[model samples]
Target: MAQVHLRDVVKNYGPLEVVHSINLDIADNEFVVLVGPSGCGKSTTLRMIAGLEEISGGEIFIGDNVVNDLPPRERNISMVFQNYALYPHMTVRENLGFSLKIAKRPQAEIDKAVDEAAEILSLTPLLDRKPGALSGGQRQRVAMGRAIVRHPDVFLFDEPLSNLDAKLRTQMRVEIKKLHQKVRSTIVYVTHDQVEAMTLADRIVIMRDGHIEQIGTPLDVFENPVNTFVATFIGSPPMNLLNGVVRDGAVVLEDGTTVPVPPGYQAREGQAVQLGMRADNVMPVGHSLPPTEHMAQIEMDVNLTEPLGTETLLFAELAGAEVQAKMLNPRPVEAGERMTFQVMLDKCHLFDAESGAALRG
Candidate 1:
């Protein structure tokens, strides 16, 4: 029953503020991820929750207790850092049980906790091996096992997979998700990777420049981004934005190409806006998804093609800006080839050109 609550937390170094006052509540046994680009204050926020960094203002509550004044050891939390901080000289079992050992816990209790954590992470076979003897993924598992042996009220993971290779990172993502399902602990993970946030979190907290931009379930943020920054940051290949002005129930681009404003948006005539389109929403007519009721056709010359097995990402220029569209059904097309693509207007978005806020009715 460890629910974490941050009440307008703020962090400042001397006179410069790094983390603006931000509030968040994480439910018990929930997995939440704070994701953003580098220098977004995500890791600083996690460290504040862990009591590793002192808060400049506001209170932090772990369950029913105010932990703002508590030290790291008294916060009843365990943190798994990016670099697997395993002692080189200790075997896997010793490393897992080191915290409890240092705390002067009974040998029987320590052994039981270590054994259970080892079994859970499938590290029972590597208990006798040192960190140097284990692979990166195996070492990460050992790091997680060390955190689990403590059975703390909360688990904080700070980019725990960044050091691993691409394949191992994918594998570890699955492992971390499975671990959450098994342990059911309240987890607050921090990462700059959106894919990890989307795959691992029950809810995501997106931050920028020390301020929280948005917080919602992955699908909620993906399908309904609140602004242009979020619309571009949450998805791979980024969303294509075309600057235009609303005129006669349509958006007119710089090149005199007019497209109907996406449905549900109340745009005034003569209003400046940016039309947002994901690569998935724009595709070659023959290779596109089943047609939607509200669609717009546009012609563009392909500049490049990125064949990704079942699908290819087509790069083109639209309205003076580079645009990315997906090509389904697998086709070979030379550069500079002209193609007509369909845009799913129902899935498109409209944002205020100046402020970057979503234009919703």
Candidate 2:
């Protein structure tokens, strides 16, 4: 395993600069994921690290070697892309052993490596099947097995699970995590899915436009987002945002609703801000709400309810904005009914209205 480092990395397509100068240090054996919306330069960055795309500026280091001018074959890195990229005419065993065969490795060693990869991926049953007959998930495993055969210093994945169904994607996410533990190799994965990023990464790098927004463990970025963009982008259902102003040590929402400011906050009396609260933190009464340091109770009309088996997602009107709240151990909730909800004030986030930067105390 080797550490991957990027210093002031930049990318450009002729006159248009896509990726701004970015700096990241991925520790040895670390499973780092680069995630963002489409065209955010995540795949481009991954390609640069794999030596598939040329860098416009700065340097990339794999362990103690400077691999700026190295070709893909010389970089000792294997990349699995979104498409399976397996040969239709080749059997799973052949596909896994092709790279070694191309390097003129002895047939016995190639067979040994192929068998080992098949065992690790549980693909021994499908080894004789051609890519055409295999399922999507199985074909993807063969793609990963090919990479495993190389025993590369770094493994790169470019949204490798995007082509699968939701259920299969979840299963593969767990398989990929186990693969990391079994191989103990450095991996750089790229994806636009926050669910995948949250579940599989040791640390996640959130990108927007062409710049890195924030980099931290999934929980760190989720709990303490630096800006409104990150706050809304990193979570499911996203964080609810209510535009308002701070007055009288409380936040006044657009519809004249007032919610207590989070404790220990320092802001001007009349400063404009956006108040944010996660769905789980703000729920209807009688949901076993925890003992929060600061909380606010408000009456709001329920707009809709989405029952998701274990819990229901309640949508309601708050300060004239549609806010989503979670209801665990839920009872039947009808639309148009009035309900009293509690907002966990201590977990709330405040951001400047003008710049959208988090207002830290």
Candidate 3:
């Protein structure tokens, strides 16, 4: 395994920069994920590493060698594309051994490597089958098997699971993680799906508008987002953000309710701020005593009740705005009924109303 480093990397199209000065260090055997919305330059960043896209500036290094001038083949990297590009005419064995054969490796060595990879990937039974006869998941394994046969320093995956169905994608995620554990190869994966990023990444790089927003572990970015954009982007049901103002060391909501601020907040009294709280953090106050002495409670009409089998998501309105709260039980509830709920003040996050930057306490 080899470490990958990107130094102030950039990409442009006639002065329209798609990837801005991105600097990142990926350690050996570390699974780093590049995640962002469409047009946010995540795919561009992956392509630059794979040598499929030209860099307008900066340098990329694989191990101790600078690969800025290298082509895709010369970069010594294996890429698994979203489409699982496999030659239909070649059998599974031939597809897995193509790269070695192109490099003119000995027949015995190629056979040995292919056989080993096949065994590890459970593709040995399909070795003689053509791509046309293989299932989608099997074809995907072939694509990965081809990569494993070469044993490159870095594995670059560009939304390799995008084309698969939801169930297949979930299955593939486990398979890929297991494969990584066995091989312990350095990986750089790109995906727009936050679930994939959170599940697969050792470190997540969240990008927006061709710039890096935040880079941290999944839990770090989820629990302590750097800004309002990240607060809303990282979670499934997203964090609930309400406009408020700091009043006498407390935040006053739009409905004129005061909520105490956490200790050590730098923002002074009367400053406009945004309050952020996760759905799970907003629970029925009486169910369990909250950790924070200062609690913020709101009375609102329940708009909908979604029973998710294991848990229930309550959609309600607070201060003329829609908000969601997740409950541990699939309790019964009705819409259009007023309900009072408490928010955990200690778990709440604050952001600057004007700048959207998170306010630290």
Candidate 4:
């Protein structure tokens, strides 16, 4: 029953506003992530929810109560930070039970909570070991175990995996996902990594420049980005964009390469636009996916090739801009090799050149 609601929330430092008035509704037990580039007010917003930062304007509600004035400790929430923040001298068990110990909980209660958390995080064998004795991933597990021992109604994670190595980050991502499934607590996580947002969040709140850009499920935002920023930001390698103009039922690229406009888009004649396509949607004919109803064929010379195990990522120039295309079924094409590629028109996008907004029908 720990649903969180932010009503026109705003955070200001002196005269400069860092977080603009924003509203959000987080249902109980939902795992929501606040994600964007550095200084986008994501962490600030999470801190406000955690009662770490005082809101300059508007109200915050946790469950049925207004918690705008409550301190973080009094809000029944636990936060796992980027730094492990474990007591160096304390054993894993001691660290896990420290918060409860400070609260003067009964010894039996402390033992039970600590044991449960250790069991959940598979830290039972490390209970006697200090933080210095644990590996990076193990230390992170201990951190999570400490948070779990509190049995808080909500969990706030502020870039908890940023300090870990790439491999450990991936491992911890799985652990965190499993933790969410087991705990079933309302979680508000903040990170600048879109991959983390895509993998961990039940819904992602994409922010930019102190304002929320979009809020939706990961796939919802990926396949249907509302603007150029999101189209380029949410996915790896980003969607390719090329300057173009709509002319006679086709989009004419900068170098006079004409491609049929994508399906289901309302493009004005003679309007400046940017044609968008993802590497997955553009592929060499023999190495392409099943042919779709609406497709455009184009020829380009491969400038570079990244041979991923299953598919190769072919880099080529289109309309004077570099565009990435995927090559399936394996290929050993040298640089400067000419190849005909099929563009999945239904999967492509068009954005207003001036505003970068999607052109939907």
Candidate 5:
């Protein structure tokens, strides 16, 4: 295991700069996931760390050694690609042992490494099978096994489970977590899936347009996003953002209804602001409650409801903006009916309409 560090790292292709100055420190044996939308430069950053892409500027260090001039192999790092990158003609055993053979390890050593890796990945049963005969999940396991045999200082995974079906994706997610616990190697995984980022990463690096938006644990980003973009990105059904204005120390919607503001909100009266709230925090009010400093009331028009086994997802409209609410043990609700819901303003967020930055108290 090793600590990976990047300082002002940049990646450019000819005239197009894909990744801007990035600074990060990944501790030893930590699993850090880089997550963002497509073309957000998450993969580009990972490639740069693996030495697969040239770093246009800044320094990269692996365990106190500067490796800007080193090749991928020389960095002593292993990368598992999305497509598995297996040789179709080679059997699983041969594929896993190929690197050992190229490094001139003895025949016995190669066999031992391959066997151990296969055992760890549960690929021993398919050792003689070629890539042509393996399922997508099996092929991915082979790719992981290839990385394990070398025992590299760091493991880089580029959406390795993307090619599998939904069921297999869930199954393999568990397998990958288990593998990491057993190996305890430093890993950097890149993906666009927020669920994967939330479930697997020790900390998530959220990116946008080649820049880091927020770096924190999953709960931190989900509960307190720094901007509107992040508030809309990290949630499942996403947070409901309503266009409102700050007036008299509260947020007033377009329909003239008001919601309370938390203590830290410093918006001036009648100033334009966007109020952000989570779906899970939107609760249906069964009775009248005293107005609190951290609470706001709203009328939601039910558009649709989706039953998701344990909970119901309610689609509604508020202040001409689409909103969603997640309710536990939700009763049947009819469309076109006005339902009263309370917004937990203590958990609410405020963003500047123009700059999109969260309004600091």
Candidate 6:
């Protein structure tokens, strides 16, 4: 295992610079996931760390070795790609041991290494089968096993679960997490799925437009986002944001509904701000949750309700915009009906309307 560090790393293509100067430190044996939307330079950053993309500026260090000019192979890192890049003609055993064979290891050494990798990934039964005969998830395991035989200092996963079906993807996620716990290698995984980042990473690096938006543990980022973008991005169903103005130490929405502003929030009366709340923090009175700081009640017209087994997602109009909230142990309700819900103002977030930044006291 190794610690990876990037200092002012940058990527440029002619006159256009896609990745701005970014710095990050990845500790030894830590699983850090880079997550972002499409075209956010997340994958580019991962490739740069693997030495697959040339840095336009700054230095990259993998275990105290400056690797800015090093090739991917020289970095002693193994990469698992999204497409399961396996050799169709080679059996799983041969595929896993190919790197060792190319490095001139003896047959016994290759066999031992291949066996170990297969055992780690539960691919022992499929060792004799070729990639053409394996399922997508099995083939992906073969790809990871190939990387394992090399005993790399770091592992880079470029959306390795993207090719599998939803069920297989969930299953593979557990397997990957188990593999990490067992091997304990430093890993950098890149994916667009926030759920993947939440469930897999020790810490998540959220990137946007070539810049890092936030880096925090899943719960940390979800509970206290730095801005509207982050507040809306890290959680499922996103956060509900309502435009309002500060008045008499509280926020007044467009429709004259008021929710208390948390004490010590730096805001002046008549300031334009946005009130943010997560779905879990808001609930109908009957489906009660304890209040945080202050709880304010409001009635809105229900537009939709989606029953998600354990909870039902309710969509209603608030401050002229549709906001979503969750109802746990929910009872059925008809659309277009009026209903009352409580907003937990203490758990709320406030953002400067013009800058979109969280208002700090």
What lDDT tens digits, residue by residue, belong to model 4 across residues 197-266? 9999999999999998888999999988888988998998799999999999899999999999898787
C-alpha displacement of 178 in model 2, angstroms? 0.6
What is candidate 2's lDDT per residue for 85-133, written digit by digit as tens? 9988899999999999999999999999999999999999999999999
Model 3 whole-model lDDT (C-alpha atoms)? 0.89
Per-residue lDDT, model 1, residue 36, is 95
lDDT per residue, candidate 1, 74-118, as tens digits?
A: 999999998988999999989999999999999999999999999
Reference-based TM-score of each model:
0.98, 0.97, 0.96, 0.97, 0.96, 0.97
lDDT tens string, model 3, 1-361?
A: 4999999999999969888899999999999999989999999999999999988999999999888889999988999988999999999999999999999999999999999999999999999999999999999999999999999999999999999999999999999999999999999999999999999999999999889999999999998899999899998898998888898888888998777774445577888998888888776545434457767776768889888887788888877677888766556887887777887777788899999998885
State how far residue 55 of model 4 sits from its true place (Å). 0.8
Better-scoring candidate (lDDT), 3 or 4: 4
Instruction: For candidate 1, report its TM-score.
Output: 0.98
* Number of clashes found in candidate 5: 0
Model 4, CA-based lDDT: 0.93
Q: In model 4, what lDDT does residue 187 have?
A: 93
Per-residue lDDT tens digits for candidate 5, residues 1-361, read 4999999999999999989999999999999999999999999999999998889999999999999999988999998999999988889999999999999999999999999999999899999999999999999999999999999999999998889999999999999999999999999999999999999999999999999999999999988788898888998878788888888888888988788765576787877888888887786675323445567677889898898877778899888888887667667878887888877777788888777778868
Runs with alpha carbons beyond 4 Å of true place in candidate 1: none
- Candidate 4 local Cα displacement, residue 20, angstroms: 1.3
Tens-digit lDDT string for candidate 6 (262-297): 554678789999998888878987886766657888
Highest TM-score scorer: 1
Q: After superposition, how far is residue 351 of candidate 2 from its true place, in Å?
A: 1.1
Task: List the candidates ranked by lDDT, beginning with the highest.
Answer: 1, 4, 2, 6, 3, 5
Name the 10 consecutive residues with the lowest summed lDDT in model 6: 287-296
What does each candidate score in C-alpha RMSD? 1.0, 1.2, 1.5, 1.2, 2.1, 1.3
